[model samples]
Target: MFDQNFIENPYPTYRALREAGSAHWNGDFLGGAWLLPRHADIAPVLRDARLSAQRSHCYSALLPEPVQPAFAEFNRVFGMWLLFQDAPEHTLLRKLMNKGFAPQVTDLWRDAITRTAHTLIDRLPAHGTVDYMGSFAHPFPALVICELMGVDARDQAEFIEWSDAIARFFGNPASSLEVAYRGRDSLLAMTRYFEAVVEQRRHAPGDDLISLLIRIEEDEEALNGEQVASQCSMLMFGGHETTRNLLGNGMLALLRHPDQMQALRDDRSRIPNAVREMLRYDSPVQYLTRIAAEDFEYAGAQIRRGQMVVPLIASGNRDETRHADADRFDIGRADTAHFAFGHGPHVCIGTRLALLEAEIAFDALLARCPHIAAVDTRPEWLANFGFRGLSTLRLDMQTQPADAGAVAA
Candidate 1:
């Protein structure tokens, strides 16, 4: 599954897997786990109480001796992340974190998001080619999240590098020892950076997420220093990683289908629906891991406790039973119930923010770049299986004049 071809396009393999069975036993991958590829099966399993999000407790025994120590730092950092927690603990943390991400708070940033999008668009060359991913897609959200988190503009590059390094550990459990050590170092560095930031906020808070988290108290409980640092780390990384890919992938999808691009450009009203379809067509996050907390019978297969259950979300999005003509990419597709942001209790906390960011991004891009075309139709894909994104997306664009009313409302 880690093969380069599979990383580039796993849909073919996913269809084959789903055809074989709803769930398949893969003893070779991740030391014996069940790969669930069908939407009929994956949807329910995601919401099942028996399936636990805390994989470390279930898969610890499978780790090799050398990798276990490195994972100690990994777990210490990611374990506290709301995505990996369960039950009351998950409930508590989510409620506390939600204060900083309230809809009103996110809505307030719309103007800033639009301004940021326009600022990045203005930097694009009028008639030259540029790698959209690096120039705009990647850094746009990174800058937005940094502003929200009270991070210094000068340190944006370092923060993004740290987040990228840490993200390697996800969806690639069989990573080499070198990658494992690098992830460990990245985690340690993030921990130290956030630790000092949290301390600074505690003494003298600001109007950032870190300050809000420090002051937020629910049921007489508040996030401690360690928890504050961990949540900030997750938000800083999680905030932009998937959203960056969404922008890149969404634009590429539009470029591939000229009709859809024209439809969106003609009617700005279609941009929101187009963003939803883009997420469904090529989800940013492809797969997630869950562990069976207890024995359960699923699709005639007996799942044992402590066994890994891998849900192929990218495949599920294309499942025929759930979506009509699933293979086709239509921006106007009515059924937008894709599992791109996941499902059930663990759905992405930043879903609202991501959607808003993508909406504003596409709006600005279409308006500012009157004629956008892909320089390289076949761009390289990221090696990680968990997150589906392009490594680079080169594009040649024709920028509208400054007074051409290209600025998004």
Candidate 2:
């Protein structure tokens, strides 16, 4: 079905789909999926404001009937949150939420990100190998969000567990009902937890994002406690999970290609470009599906209204028409446009924070641990389809510490 074997790896499958034509839909398995690889086709689809991420407009009906109720319920609760809204409503939600993600806010976080990088790495085991994903990458953003949200230190562990379980929806197919139910319960628990936090902030606020949200609420009648809570929860989970994969997956890219790693080590300034290369080479998010609001002709196939349309973003990153030697991982590639952060109005609002966190984290890791290599042991892939990353990436490092002073000298 795929040019690439779907079981082991799907990139080859995506490549073949792209080669076949611009937008191709295959009903082979997983309830049918489409691949919109061409830029010309993807741009129009994203710009079309009538479509949305809501389940009602879902391009894919692969989800079981029972599962839709759970998802639909969650969608109803989070309706005002930007991720679920479209067009004019989406614009308002995005505008408000983006206040916290403004350029000034992102710039303010540069130093905090640096400190976070150092603090996380310093805690790693000195000589023995460690699961960089668990010990470092995942927690890095979690800590940042905790501090940013004024989450009590005591509650941090619970938050991680809740996030992990809710994250499983996108993970590989569930083993049984128990897992899916647990994941749903975790999502509800998290929503309730944040709901309380939002109320708490309303009564006894601090100088944090939550407080700012309350202030936004007072000024705008459009927002309320439930709205604020939903948005905050979305930001918390989205920021934490997507970035965890970015740092962890980006590091994996470097380990798999030693030459690029060496270059970053030799000239630290190249870290910025190297980060972009990492983004293009191994995007954090693999696929994004957008529902077609109306019938549209694409790649010789006719798409019906409310049909699910998935942009195989990972495939688009490697489309020969868009990128030269698309499969090759070259840090020096001039033309780079990977849908890592997505595209269009619904694009990731936390992109600046994400990129900032990645740049600082990568710079610190390479500067601190030289000749770092993926451990001989098998690395753990987080069993999620919505995202790709290591569950636990054990890595070997240079026994000698490479502190700030050592690197400078």
Candidate 3:
């Protein structure tokens, strides 16, 4: 599964896994784990309190005996992330963090998100090949998250570097010790950067997420300084990495299926549904890891405690039992149920925000670049199993920004 072929397309492997059995124990993945490829089994595991999200311990355990101590900080910081926490702590942190991520708050950024997308699209070459991932996909979400966090625009490049390093490590289950080192360094750098920003926000609060977190700490006394900074790091990495991949993957899917692209262009209302299909067709997040909280019977297999269980989200999204014509990519498809953002307690809190960003991004791209096509038929996918996305997407775009009269209309 770590080969180039699987990286380019893992759905076939997922199908095989699902057909072979309900769950297959693979000894190679993250030091032996059970892979759940079917939706029926994965859905319940996500909501089951018996499965724990605290899988940071596995990181150090995967490292060499000599270098294990180097990853202590990495384990500590990652364990603090909202994505890796369970009830009680997870519940309280989510409630306090909700003040900044609620739909109402997300709606406030519609104009900003739209404007950012258009700005990036406008910079693309009118009649030549360009890498959309660099010009737009990667930076669009990075800039929006930066604006949300009140970070200086000049710091965007460094932030992106930090994000990429952390994402590359976490998203690759077969990552090397070298990758672990880079991830640890980047994580620490980002945490320190956010810690400084948090101090500044403390002295002078603004309307951004940092300020909101500081307020949550002060008013409720729920979060310490380190915890506040940890959330900032998590949000910064999560907010940018997943959304960037979605834009890239969605664009590639549209380029591959012209009819679906035309459907979206024909009726702008379909953009939302189109976004959902894009998610299902090629999810940015391929799977999620959980530790068995207790011994339990699942799919006729007895799972021991402290064992790693992986829910293949991308596979479940393509499950024929749950979705009609699951393999097909149709923008107009009515069914939007998917585990792209996950399910149950650990479901992505930025679901609405991610959808909104993709919607605005596609709308702006189609509106401005009436003619868009991939430069190469063979796509280049990032060498990662856990995170499915393109490494680079070159495209030919003919720009035609809407006229002033049309905008007014």
The TM-score leader among the candidates is 3
User: Ten residues in a row with the worst lDDT in model 1?
Assistant: 400-409
> Worst ten-residue run, lDDT, model 3?
400-409
Q: Kindly provide the TM-score of model 1 when superposed on the true structure, using C-alpha atoms.
A: 0.95
List the pairs of residues colliding in candidate 3.
none
Query: What local lDDT does model 1 show for residue 98?
Result: 89
Ranking 1 against 2 by lDDT, winner? 1
lDDT (10s digit) by residue, model 3, range 1-409:
6688888888899999999999989888888888999989989989999899999768668878899888888899889999999998898888887777878889988877887887787788788988988889989998998988899978888988998888878887667887888988999999998889888888989998788777774255467778889998988898888898999999988888888888888998789989999999899999999999899989767889988899999999999999999999998888978999999988888888899999888888888888898998887887777777777899988887655543332
State the local distance difference test value for candidate 2: 0.71
Candidate 2 C-alpha lDDT tens digits along 1-409: 4321342256777776776788776564234555676655666676676556764223113356676566555545545457767766777777777777779867876766677778778787767778788888888888888777888756767877877776665343322455555655766677788789888988999877777776763245556787777777777778888888888778887788788888788888887787777777767777776666777676666888766677767777777777888888877677767777888887889888888888788888877776588885456676566577777888876534547664332
Go through the candidates in order and give each one's C-alpha lDDT. Answer: 0.84, 0.71, 0.86
Candidate number achieving the greatest lDDT relative to the actual structure: 3
Clashes counted in candidate 3 amount to 0
Return the clash pairs for model 2, or none: 4-12, 4-13, 59-307, 59-308, 60-308, 170-385, 171-383, 171-384, 172-383
TM-score of each candidate structure, all chains considered together: 0.95, 0.89, 0.97
Candidate 2 ranges with C-alpha deviation above 4 Å: 1-8, 28-30, 56-72, 78-80, 171-176, 217-222, 399-409
**Each model's backbone clash number:** 0, 9, 0
